[model samples]
Target: MDDSQKRETQQRLQSCLPQIHEIHSICQTPSITFGVVHNGEVIFKHSIGHRDAQQTLPANDETIYMIGSCSKMFTSAAVGILVDEGKLSWTDPIRKYVPEFDPVDDPRIGQEADIIDCLRHSTGLSPPSMLCLGPGGTILTDEEDLIPLLNVMPAVDGEGKERFNREWIYNNYVVGLVALIVQRVSGQRFADFVRGRILDPLGMRRTAVRRSDLGGDGNVAAPCVKKSNGRFHGLSDESWPCEEYTPLLAATGMRSCLNDMLTWCIAVLDAERSENDSSYQSQVPNNPLKQMTRVRRGYWTRPADDPEFSKDAAYGMGWFRADIPSSMLSAFSGNGFSREKEYRLHLQHILGKGSEAAPFQVVGHTGGMRGSIFSVFTFPETQSAIVTMTNGRDFGDASDFTAQLLIQALFDMKPTLDLASWARTEAQLAGSNYQKHIERPWRENRHLGDLERDPLLYVGDYRSFNGRFTLSIGGVADGWSTNLSVKFNHRNASECPLVFYRKDVYSFYQVDEDKWKIQQIGAREYKQMLLKFQVDEGGNSVEGLWWQWDADTKPAWFENVRNRNSTQKGAPFLVKSYSG
Candidate 1:
């Protein structure tokens, strides 16, 4: 983490990018965004790539990206809002507010997963899946209504995680549901409560859930459009078709630009500073709901996502334990981006422990999507925070990298990565591909003289055998091309191509031995995906076979037939999502 070290790391990161770009060639678009915050101020901000290959736009600090599970922080904060009101308690059985909620697993463990467990993910629950179609099962995204799904999802995984926790369930779905419980008890809609209690008070003007409420998505960053073949379609105007903030308002769906997010971090940092000087409870301007703060004895009492993080400050209602030195007295929270097949991710993290500057519990959270990366750091003791937001999935690991870099820079230490050397390596790789003529750009690769020019077409009603996927062609685009993406029931944006490895089989072919053979090229490097094709009459279309990772789907299937313009349905019922 020194200057020379940071420069070298930067060089390596930059160098590894072209090879990374090759991965994007098949994994769909690549957009890289980066920013840094130090000493509670914006030190640097930059966007490394295009939003799409359209070459029309570039992401900026204000561009909003869905933080995915990072929304859990918001849900957790909402819980704190309720605690501020004294209407809810961390130890209270969720049933106190959500009486209808019943553990579908061991009856003995009923009500054991309390508010803390929900926020810290100790419920001993596993990701759910009952819908039929692919292999393994898919992790239920928070936007997907889950309460009823929880009841119906076969409780095969059982509770009892590594620690005194539940199975590997999607924690945010439940957390959001619990947030709903808070709303119901407090008589305040979750969004309103969060805004009035946390955001508005903290000056997070752009942090909002409703698009209509956020006043027109507001300079939002677009999600990536992965092709059936696993390459980034580059940056496109295509959005997540569904309301970014509806469905349940629990784990995902909220939006805020890097700048606003940074302000939020500063607010949390400042609040910590403010609370220490005066009475912690007396500062509320008007208490529609009470807010409380306490440092739990342990970092994480139930589960351990990774053992090394054992010393983690652990969960405090909604906040996460950051890895920054406790002597620094700070905390951090955020999610990481994963353009994986089943989940919409940004492997978020939080780190905090009072720092000497303000000297109180400081918290930091980070989120990334597509290819952008962002960080929000706050020193609760000083009530000061800094935020950095970027756009790109390739930059998923950049937040931590950038953070370490910024800290080093502020302290005037050696850097960890070198941009010049890194850029050179990337250029070499890109140049090699260009020389080999594999850089098809968009024009040459997609436009195949005619739609039927190729005999092996992948067109059909494809579904995952694991009971987790349902995808069809939307329509034909750019002439010889038909627009294809996952079906609506597939979760998240529903339009993103669900990349399934092994179970995933969408591929391109080149002439070989007088017959077309699987191209054995452009398969995802970091993610999982597959390809397959079928023929109809003399014409051929493509149908992709991918898995829903969120679900336990591994054995997927393909069916029916059409020219990539078909639709399908499944069991009907109403369920709640995690928007609370």
Candidate 2:
């Protein structure tokens, strides 16, 4: 591209500022830092909103934000490095490195699943529901405990069957297992390995794999979320800090700045370009970037009528591959700010003119955590990329929408619909629906009245079938009210009062404090856990309780193991005392 084309591109991007600001304001996002990379160089950079909840600190190029699952690319690259060295092969079975990794649900999965199967998400493992942390918002089990828990975990089909190499199920635990393999094989901590091999080499000095490594960096953006009141609130540092994510660090615990991320993107784009050159030999043998970006599984197919049309959308090791239609380019003709009219015109103005309706391939990934989200796109054919990072979550898919808008602008693709309106409407509907879903049980069954047995009978220690989790029910007295609440892993901080829904079922909502502390980060949809008590054969004594935590699969059973001596015959059994 010549100077004239570059100026024109800049002008088009400049025209997008108003729309970007409008979306940011509407979403109530705390901050967004983005950059565009063209021909191996950063062509444009911009930042909006504030880095802090107080709105005193301005976000800029140097403000660091957690990239969340975007760290998967780095982990895959680390594995690729091992492959290049012949230290391990992608075909190697997981049991080879971790002998204890035997899933009892499907012994064949434990015996047959190879590295590629896990990376490609074809291992058939159900998505991990409560594996990362206990109800207290802290790491419960360590590396050793993960293996045994996984042994009894259900498959994607909810039956003890294997889907290995057949279906795609996004399992973060399996990816964490891959990182563990990297640690064991490379003989270095996962964080240390990634920093030395990838971050240092690429000169991403601002990137840190662990929070401890960040060490007094005042420029780091505070994780936050926008509330219904249209205000941003910063989450507590202890909520879900990087340190607590040690076991899954490789999966989702890297913090980086716009400048550093742009550097990383350039490296990936350069690697892809070099691979296409027959005469170009990489200094690093076998080049993991090629393997990481190579499409391995097809996940979706969008028809031509779709606004962001793509015939085939697939997943590689960590990146997603898709094609954008070329015919969506047209001219802009509209006036001022209207959700329907303005967005369409803005999109058209950026797109410029329509040409042949062809499609071009692009690869990237989207990541989210408690209060941060990211979207990255690399147009290998054009040697360009877009990286967007925001320090807010749950309000909407602000980062992703921004990336899509930029992609259309860069490629001169016209607007097929009012994307901004669509995104905002969807977000609002999702939040509203989720609130109703959680309240449905109570709303429907409240008239059924309390349980037949004493509520104290449910008080006890309950353990999961696999013994991976423990729940304790106890009485809490606040002011004049006394109620029974359950706590995960016996942590007092995680306790939530149990409300009677029906005769044998009781419901409780977790993370209420976290919800008030921040604006519902991490959890896109709030849910309530229901517990159903089981009576012994005589129907006089409590035996166990069935827990319905995740609504997707079967409810897990937890045996009540209260000691007989802990409670006297019919008085309120107060095993533990809590003050108001």
TM-score of each: 0.58, 0.84
Predicted model with the maximum TM-score: 2
Which residue segments of model 2 deviate by more than 4 Å? 134-137, 156-161, 237-246, 280-309, 326-357, 415-418, 440-442, 445-448, 478-481, 491-493, 510-528, 537-540, 563-580
Clash counts per candidate, in order, are: 150, 2
- Cα TM-score of candidate 2: 0.84
Overall lDDT per candidate, in order of appearance: 0.43, 0.65
Per residue, candidate 1 scores C-alpha lDDT tens digits across 42-139 of: 44455545555354677676666666545656676666666666777877877777666665544433556577766666665544422311211122
Clashing pairs in 2: 328-414, 329-414
* Lowest lDDT block of 10, candidate 1: 513-522
State the TM-score for model 1: 0.58
After superposition, candidate 1 runs with Cα above 4 Å error: 1-53, 129-145, 152-170, 213-218, 225-248, 277-292, 295-318, 323-362, 370-372, 379-386, 413-580
